[model samples]
Target: MTALRALLLTVAVTASLSACNRRDREPAADAPLPAAEAPAEITPADAAAPMNFATTSPYAAVKLTLPNALKAQTDLHARLYADEVRLLRQFVEGAQADRSEAGDDPSIPPYEKTITLTAAAETGKLVSLRRDMSEYSGGAHPNTTARGVLWDKALKQVIGSGQLFRRGADMSLLDQALCAAVNTARARRVPGAPPLTLAGGGEWTCPRAAATPFVLAPGTVDGKAGGLTFLIDPYKVGPYAEGSYAVTVPLTTFRTLLAGAYADEFAGQPAN
Candidate 1:
């Protein structure tokens, strides 16, 4: 009887030990699950691939190309994408409405909107980009527009034209310099056209350097900024027939106007 009791006690102890082992191996019902793996980071190589979107139907056609340089920065890329998508949606809606009202007019041309962003210069942490957008919805011709984007790599955001200069800096000097450059370019394009005056008169009035869109242009030396290139779309300083004008103002022309933070980023003469 004593041997039988000892045997029973041993069996109970063994079962208890096994139960404890099982409890240690299995997770508690209330315990949190393992975390999911994080998404891969975007590298320069991944950003090199441009983001392109295109679609066409009987109603309309849309095409957009965002350069890889713009994609390198996370926030900038998201902002640009959202803006482009919004514009694209508006165009699509307009096309749908036009088609509905026109009642299957086969002769009507399909509406179009093409937008492209190109890297103008990349020096240090500054990236200058030019955006050209063309849209046509049964007009005399497709209207084209140009804009400049100055992106700061370190900040991961866009730097406005006003931010590049000192607080309340007298831009009159820069304006005069840009006006002179525009006249030079105008002479080459339209030999007999009247020069643009800063006095703001008629169609030939010179655009203010502060109000115009401009990008940093490449310098003669590699990896350096030469100057600012003002992007003047058609009908700005001249008639639409003259097309667009890209007047470059060398660093020497507007060096003193630069903010203290941006003084070191510019050097050399314009490569063009």
Candidate 2:
């Protein structure tokens, strides 16, 4: 099966925007010391101007079957995929099944349900349809906090705008092979694996030993803006494996951001 990529891979940071307002016609400062001006009358929703979602450039989507495996070979591999999914389901199902005898459950177990998208990826879109989404760990994100605010705004921009929202994942930690596609993906390695040699006269080096010694083939993507660093050795985690995942942008968000991003904040104003 094709590895599910570009699925629910989202990362975020704090951002904001500023709007200009017109000055109210008033008399001299001395004359203004009279009755305090009443607070600007608040506008009701029905009376407020409509917001244009089209200008926004974010598309909401959920990554299905991520942080989960599909198949396994050995018992060890089984633990990596199927077994893990089962145990996770057990936790989500909770003690309801334990109080009843087999085939007598008033409520059926959840593991058998077909919903597969993680809560993080499915956020801000059609939610009631994916009833089983409650079980996703990432889905139960807390609101009323700073991260929650950013998530909501960012997600709104993404879904409402229908723009391409690319999630960056650091796979250099998972599979060194991906380094072939994104040179920035370099991770530690195991012995007897490929070594990260300084290739093409680049100053890059393998952080750890490879399965075998090899050159650190540093390269660039054609007409792309980011650097690609390759990792050679395969690192192992006890009874499992791990790697880095990152999101990469492709001009769209960056261009959209130029209007309000870190560098664009000073735009539409005087040269100070």
Candidate 3:
């Protein structure tokens, strides 16, 4: 009987020990699971997402969007955001003042401003962007503008279009080509409209290449830039009614004028 009791006690102790071991090895029902590991690098879709902001009030309404590609560029993105903030503050103040003076004038519509920045092309260490802005402040019609930006990923800075050309290089050839292209585009938009003159009086005068904002256009060949697409805002080369114009100057037109550093970046033709 004593031996049997000892055996039973031994079995109970072993079962308890085993139960404890099992409890130690298993997770608690309420415990949180392990967190997922983040990706080592940003994916293309993540880089292409846009950062957007908007607000509306009785005095004004404002909207702004910045592409993730631009936002990924830390320094440039900071500068652009600072500039936008300043502009936004000014607009809000102006709108408030106008409202105060108007004293509930129903005819005065709420002032508005919308700005969007989008990636136009990316080649090598350069990313091209386009900015379109529209604003209205008690005007018959809203005013719209478009501009281009070239960001150097290596340098982490904005570069002017002139940098693509050799120092002291005569840009007259480029200007002539751009003018011809603009006139050709203008003719198609407004049938029988007088052709734009390179150096003529009035709003119909063709804007010089130096005066236009241009982005590196995507090319047919991968990893190579096709050409430059000039962004012309309203009232620059034509009446406001004609709206904006985008004219692409092929690489072949200005390939000879390219700086040694940028020559290799150009090839094929514009994708669109």
lDDT of 1 by residue, 1-272 (tens): 12212211121211111212322121111101112233224446444434876778887788878888866666566555544554565566667676666674788777777878888998887888787777666645666767777777786656766668888888998899999999999998889778889997766789899878788999997888899999887778876677888999999988888888877788999999
**Local accuracy of candidate 3 as per-residue lDDT tens digits, 151-248:** 66786555665577888887888899898998899889998888777878655788788767788889999988899999887777777778889999
Q: lDDT value for candidate 2?
A: 0.21
- Worst 10-residue lDDT window for candidate 3 reads 26-35
Cα lDDT, all candidates: 0.69, 0.21, 0.67
Report how far off residue 20 is in candidate 1 (Å). 83
How many pairs of residues collide in model 1?
0
- RMSD for each of the candidates: 24.2, 24.7, 25.3
- Over 117-221, each residue of candidate 2 has an lDDT whose tens digit, in order, gives 212111122111100121111112211100000111232211111111123422233233333323433322233333344232333333321221111111132
**Which scores better on TM-score, 1 or 2?**
1
TM-score of each: 0.78, 0.20, 0.77
Off by more than 4 A, model 3: 1-50, 201-203
Winning candidate number (lDDT)? 1
